[model samples]
Target: MIHGILNLPRNIWLIGLISLCNDSASEMLYPVIPLYLSSVLMAGPRALGIIEGIAEATASLLKLFSGVIMDRTRTAKPWIILGYSLAGFGRPLIALAGSWGWLLLIRFADRVGKGLRTSPRDALLASCAAPNQRGLAFGLHRAMDNAGAVIGPLLAFALLSREVPLAHIFLWAIVPALICLALSLKIRESAPAASAPKRVAFDWRLGDMPLVFKRYLVVVALFTLGNSSNMFLLLRAKEVGMPSEYVPLLWAAVSAVAMIFSIPLSALSDRVGRITVLVCGYTAYAIFYFGISATEKNTGALFLLFGLYGLFMGATEGVEKALVVDLVAEDRRGTAFGWFNLTTGLFLLPASVLFGFLYQGISPTCAFLFSGCCAIAAALLLIFFVANRRP
Candidate 1:
């Protein structure tokens, strides 16, 4: 499996490296931002919910359009490059922030870069690999991404352990972001193949998409409605008696588990089936969320459940994209990915808000139960209604 994955492609490997750098930088800030909001700025869960919801929704709107742009342009590298550049510069600006509003502004710019880059990047990844190897290619990319997530928090932990100011640590994220930008420019872009047929008019009409893709989108949107911002999980760890400084390690633990399991599970998907692996991943998510809902101050249980949550992410994240590619025509992949991301993001805002309110106004158990139930429903729906086709 390792040898096969290593044989993917030069562009795939480079893309993974770029993802590593980008995610490394992003995770450095991600686990810290909530803490910065609550502890430093003295904000509340609702504030966190609003900030994440708005930031994600802003990115979703851009994702809705960026796919069309990429399809029209028939090139991804330029958009990918531009997106990374914005995020690279934008993330560091949080260091100067004195209020949650400033953090919100910084998040807006950063996620806009994400919204711009994601679909095009997925398009490029699809274009570079053979159809048979899409699972491996995406899996490797996600593994590298999660590996970076692991390293980023460890780096943050190191810096914080030395008594570095939290805001100052935000500035360090720029270094990896710059590295990601520099490496992204090295990706070689090719014009569309002459043998390829001309594409239809690029638009957001859902009727234009294939039935399989549309059905898959429904399942995806359902699942995403429960996939609230991970900040809630971090906050849960804190609420369960984990100390503030140790939060990054908890995040790293999750990422490390994700990094470790991504390749094996993705490769398994290639052999068994995409939907099978997807269902398993969703089941794992449901179980983990349920466990989180029920557990108390048992640090051992929290750690174990968090690691399983990582396994859920590893199994689903990249493989789901590979499945998306399989369900659509090659020419429409960018648009398909765009819609996938757009709808997912669209639901995330409300998801985050609902989870936040549950956590604050009710309890963490209520929040986790809601998410777990949603995951189960999405999984059952996919098995029964969406995954009937072989592709």
Candidate 2:
């Protein structure tokens, strides 16, 4: 198993390295963004909700457009390069925001880069590997991403502990972001066959996609309705008696857990079945959210629960992308991934806002319990409606 994964195609490793650099730059801000909003800008949960929802929705909508174009062009490297450049440029600008509104605009720009790159990059990875090896390929990518997530938070924690200005730390995210952009230029896309026909029309409908792919999109949309933003999870730690100082470290811890498990669990899905692994991952989300909903001021339990959530993330993230590849024709992968990201992000548009409302209007417990219910519903849908469709 180890030897096989270690020997994945060169493109996969290069792309994963790019992901690692970008994710490291992004995660550096993840641990600080909410805190900056709440503590520095005097924003509330509602504002945070609005920002996350709108930003994610914008990204999702663009992913669809970007993917469709990438497929039509039969070229991936340019989109990938532009996407990284935009994100690298946009990230540091967030440090200049004096209000949540400013933050939203800058953040939207950053997500634009994310939306632009994601589908094309995933498609590129799919193209680089064999059908049966996709799980390991995607897993390696996600593991690298999570490894960066680990690094980002630790760097943030270290800087904050040393009394660095928050703005300076935000500025620092640009370093890895720029590195990612530079490295992306190294990826080479082969020329299309001379006999290939030029695409004349844009395709927005999934009318010709497999029934399984379509149903799986519905399941993802349903599940995403409950999967609130990670900001809420961090906020929950603060609410449950964890000191503010440790939250970044906690973020690092969860990423560490995810990085450790992502490759193995995703590779496992290749043999056992994608649906089987997805069901378990969703089930873990249900359990974790319910546990979080019921727990009081117990930091210990939250850490344990967070660890479980990380394990669940490892089980699902790469495997889900691999499953999408499994469901579609090789030629249609970029568009399929776009639709997949679009469905989930579109639903998440509302889900994050609703969670914020529940957290503020009723109780945090109510919000989490609602998320748990959605997870359960999604898991059941996976079990009954979606086929495993292993390659």
- The candidate scoring highest on TM-score is 1
What lDDT does model 2 reach? 0.88
For residues 1-391, write the lDDT of model 2, one tens digit per residue.
7898888888898999998888888888898998899988999888988999999999998898888877788888988999889988789988899999999999899989989999999999998888878888989999999999999888888888888888888889778977887899889877877876555455556786888899899899999999978899998888888777678888888898989999999889889988889899999989999998888889889889999888888999999999999898876888898999999889988999999999999999999999999999999988888865423
The worst-scoring run of ten residues by lDDT in candidate 2 lies at 196-205
How high is the lDDT of residue 71 in model 1?
79
- Candidate 1 C-alpha lDDT tens digits along 156-207: 8888788898889988877887798889989988877677667687655687
- Every model's TM-score: 0.97, 0.97
Which lDDT value does model 1 have at 344?
A: 91
In model 1, state the lDDT of residue 166. 89
